[model samples]
Target: MTDDDDLRTRLHRADPAADVPPTAPDRVSRLLEKTMTTTTAAPRRTTALRPTRLITLAAAAVVLIAALGTWFVLRPDNTPGAPVAAPTVTEITAPGIAAKCAEPTADRLTEAADLAFAGTVTTIDGRIVTLEVTNVFRGAPTDVVRVAQTGDISETMMGSGKFEVGRDYLVASSEGSMLTCGYSGEASSPGLAGLYDTAF
Candidate 1:
């Protein structure tokens, strides 16, 4: 016998279902037709779901876009009135030299001074002196005041004759210039409060 014939004989002898009968041709054809129908139906079902999924996603996108548009239209500006502006800064310069001061009179203070207030010195930085106004004596109301010191201390001012932090002062100014000839002095200086009271 040939080698191929010998191999076929061995396979047949070793086959577990060698005695089982073959399936009928009609039954095999029916099984093949059922399998093809199921496979084709699966693809149709998948294709039908694609449109539904796309429509759902599109509807969600539309809702999101509408919500964002509404929020943009209705958002609060949070500004009630005029927008806030920067703090008003009143600038004044200290006298550089001492001058002969006439006796401080209430009438002179009232006539010459356009601004006067009682304030406590809050800081003395470099050549700048900042004071927090505690009371308004003869001028427009202000919360804070800054004075530019010119290194030279005027003996005309009371108590150390210069601006010092934590000391209360009664200050008078004429046209943005600080008056130093006893018109402006420490609050506790003799007759200073009385002078302001009489002037205002």
Candidate 2:
């Protein structure tokens, strides 16, 4: 052989493949499998809601349902056969009125009248009868209001008697000013007064 070839064979060489651990190929395969499993499971972990978060979502849904139910059931309306409106309670501590009339009910005088009160007739002139307002049930009124009770003013004013001056009466007006049949009647009984305390 050539002298150069012999020199090449004498040179130093390293067996890198021999130094590797025997388990290294198997270990690398196991690590690669673990990495792929972890990566696949990450999508499920991020997408799923935790138990506490699920509970919070359920509670919010329940509260929303309750609130919606309340609003739907208690809405206001004025149609006939509709539920009698809930009474608007005001300070009844105002002076009680003593009037001479009879039989006025909350139901008979449906939800039409805007104002109701027990008052004493101060004067009777033409068709107008001035009254001293004693109680305010559904509206804001001054101490005195003028009303017209024609034909038999006493029929709705109080009892069967004529609307004599200085007599007390119960008046309910739907048109705010003009008094008409049925609703405009004499209210005299203390018990009836209490029952008719609500406006339709």
Candidate 3:
């Protein structure tokens, strides 16, 4: 109606709620209501994965370790369960004229002939004569010679007999000079006869 009344109406119309002051209790009540609503709301579902993942990882590790152990145990050897190979026995025959002789020279022949001194007959068997030779040329022990003799003559000598362990005839010779000596009658270029010549 008047100027002052019009100013007052304009101010009230501009902000009617500005005249009202907010109380502390009203602000606190709003905050409490907001907190209650937030707390009551359904919580987002969280994945229960860490425990399961750890279990799965542990299982995989166990499986890997077990597989490796099994593989190692089952590994095969190059020659599995085979008997140990025996040493190769190489039969080395003696060398010289004894090898050229048709008849096999006895071991005794080498013992009897290899020495400078003559040997005595220790034992005589059919086609086999054992002699004990002394005064060995090369400090060789008294070796026994087993000669092969028949028809008033000695045949090819074979080898020396082992009359006693560690004791042998100094030399052995085959009669008729057809003596062949060797580990197993193996022939050599310079045979036992050559060896005899060198020794005597």
Candidate 4:
């Protein structure tokens, strides 16, 4: 036989055409058409948020609640229609302070003090005396001056008596407040120099 026939016989011996599935003419045409066809896909849409954003939103809510609570607890008497509390410090209401014997008069105080002035007691914070100087008859002073004292007017007593805030008084001071033995009293009283005309 010829070389072509010999090759065909060897190929048929390796694998036969009857082993392959036969394709119908209509199925072959449908497969070819589907492979060549072009189709458009619908665009995707989403409103879902990321996990980090959700956590941040929750934390902000917690902080806002905590701040509101703190303001409610710590705010000073801000509620409407509430009575205002007294601003003055509480005075020691022990039995009336005994009359200090011969509370010093003006001439004695003038002769005794290096720096004397007539001023209003703006505040007495513990042992520190804050005065609003109305008239500086002796010694250089500004409109306001602070003098140090050795005693607490509320709990303790001095020879000059307790200096009440908001009243006018004559002060006899040296380096510090040496308010003893007729050196300090009312500004308009006989205890001060300029306010009182008569000699002691």
| Candidate of highest TM-score | 1
Candidate 1's C-alpha lDDT?
Answer: 0.63
- Which portions of model 3 show Cα errors greater than 4 Å? 1-117, 148-199
| Tens-digit lDDT track of model 3 for 1-200 | 69999999898889968878777898889997666433322111111112232233233333423343342233221223422232111111222332343432433434544323223343445545444322233323332334444333212332332222222222332222322333121111124334443434
What is the TM-score of candidate 2?
A: 0.39
Instruction: Write model 2 residue lDDT over 1-200, tens digit each, in one string.
Output: 67877676565244456566677888889997667433321112211122333233234323423443342234222222322232222222111123443455567565655666654455567766665443444555434567644344433333544555554455666555533343443454334344455433
Quality of model 3 by C-alpha lDDT: 0.33
Compared with the true structure, all predictions reach lDDT values of 0.63, 0.44, 0.33, 0.44
lDDT of 4 by residue, 133-180 (tens): 434445553345565654433322332356666555555555544454
Candidate 1 per-residue lDDT, tens place, 66-181, comes to: 34334223322122231123223466777665667788899999999998876556667898988655455555555467998764756778656888765667789888778877
* TM-scores of the candidates in the order shown: 0.55, 0.39, 0.21, 0.38
| Model 2 poorest ten-residue lDDT run | 40-49
After best superposition, candidate 4 residue 42: deviation in angstroms?
90
Give the CA lDDT, 0 to 100, for residue 16 in model 2.
Answer: 54
Clashing pairs in 4: 104-182, 105-191, 106-190, 106-191, 106-192
TM-score, predicted candidate 1 vs. hidden true structure: 0.55
